[model samples]
Target: MKKILMVATNVDQIGDQQTGLWLSEFVEPATEWTHAGFEVTGASIKGGKIPIDPNSYSNELPRVWDGVMEPIHDTAKLTDINPDDYDAIFFCGGHGAMLDFPNNNEISALLDHFKQNEKLIGAICHGPAAFVGNKDVNDSSIVKGIKITGYSNEEEQGTGLAEAVPFLLEDELKEAGASYESGGPEAEHVVVDQNFITGQNPQSTHRIAEIFKEHLS
Candidate 1:
């Protein structure tokens, strides 16, 4: 079976607002991947209980998804995982990712490993924040000159946290030289550029999984 490392942020706060992993962004794809027989491992920057964006859930957690929530509630430390052990690495999105994913040495190193080994790499929504300051083995920006998509400035503004986020994902991707595109606000948009796959927002999770499974096959 193929192994996939699903990385999420440990950050649970963004300013005075509540933020963490966008529940659907992580759970939806993970459920699909698991059903497809992939050994999906949930991990975070810091090993422990992963935080869920309060806005992504309601008054009660869904019991139907309890199995999927297990690893998320107790994730492994991203730094402790060996990139070589997985066929791919997927960065799940949330506002918190903008705060923690970029400039992370471990994440950069993981991206480098995946690139050098020709392994698959993916990110969704704000998850692309992981690529902001990351470079490949050649020292060029990993996203430089690639076709990619992520949470747009429009979507950020829609949440009314445009000013709160450290940086806008769409602008950062373009500034890094990526040919960024969007399927309008809150629409399903997935971009595949060689071994890299990116999704525009939470709405794109299911399609991202389908495309990712196709790539793995």
Candidate 2:
């Protein structure tokens, strides 16, 4: 069976606000992948108890708390992961990702391994933060001159945590030399550039999954 490594943030705090992995960001795609018969493993910078963004829950969500609990609660530490064992690495987003994803040695090395091997890599919303400081096998910035997208600055500002995040995602991605693309806020936008896939916001999760499914096939 094919294996996929799904990553989420362990960070639960953003200044005085509580923030972690956004539920729909992880849930929507994860469900799609699993239903398609992929063996998915969850991991984090820290090994256990993946935090959930309190704001992502509602009366309408399918209540997948039990289905995803095992992986989320027993996450593998990013440093302990072996990129070669999986077909892809998918980063799920939230404000927490901004705290630990960028310029992180473990994540950088993991991403580098995937890029060097030409394996599929994907992220949605703030999840693209994991690509920061990563380079391809040729030693050029992985995002340099590549097409990508993520949660925009305006969207972040709309959440009222703009100042809480370490950096503005849109600006940071452009500065990293990515030809960033977007459909603005609240729009579903997914950009697939070779093996690198990124989505613009929560609304884009299903589309990201579709792209990943096509890549896997």
Candidate 3:
């Protein structure tokens, strides 16, 4: 069976309040992957119980909660894993991802490895924050000139967190030379650029996962 390393942010603190994984961003895509016969494993930057966003609670499916919670509580430390073991790496997003995914050495290494090996790599919403630190073999940002989409600046402002996040995801992606695209506010937009796939926001999760599985096949 193909294995997928589904990563969630360990940072639960967003500004003065607490935020963590966006339930749907992680669960929706994960369900798609699991149903498609992939072994999906969750991990975090800190490797422990994953924090969750309270606002994301309403969409939870009780049947899969335990399965989702299992890996969150027993996450593998990034340093302890071999990238060679997985077919893909997916970064699921919440506001928390904006806090930790960028500038994380381990996350960067995982992304670089998967990209180098021609393995699938994907992210949704602010999850694309993980791509900020990844580079190509030429030592340039891997996203340079790549068509991609992520949680947009407009969306951030709409959420009233325009100033709260460390940086604007869309702007940072553009600065990194990514051909940033947006699906115009909460719309489902999934962009596939070779082995890397990115989704615009939570609404695009399942579609992105489905695309990833299609690519694998």
TM-score (all chains, Cα) for each model: 0.96, 0.94, 0.94
User: 44-106 in candidate 1: lDDT tens per residue?
Assistant: 889899999999989887676678877798899987999879999999999999999988888
What's the distance in Å from true for residue 195, model 2? 0.8
What tens digits encode model 2's per-residue C-alpha lDDT throughout 156-204?
A: 8899988878899899888889999989889999998967999999999
Clashing pairs in 3: none
* lDDT value, residue 39 of candidate 3: 88
| Candidates sorted by lDDT, best first | 1, 2, 3
Strongest candidate by TM-score:
1
**C-alpha lDDT values of all predictions:** 0.90, 0.87, 0.85
Those runs of model 1 whose alpha carbons end farther than 4 Å from true positions after fitting are 60-64
Candidate 3: global Cα-lDDT? 0.85
RMSD of each: 1.2, 1.6, 1.6
Model 2 residue 139 CA deviation in Å:
5.1
Task: Please identify model 3 stretches exceeding 4 Å from their true place.
Answer: 59-66
Error of 1 at 148 (Å): 0.5
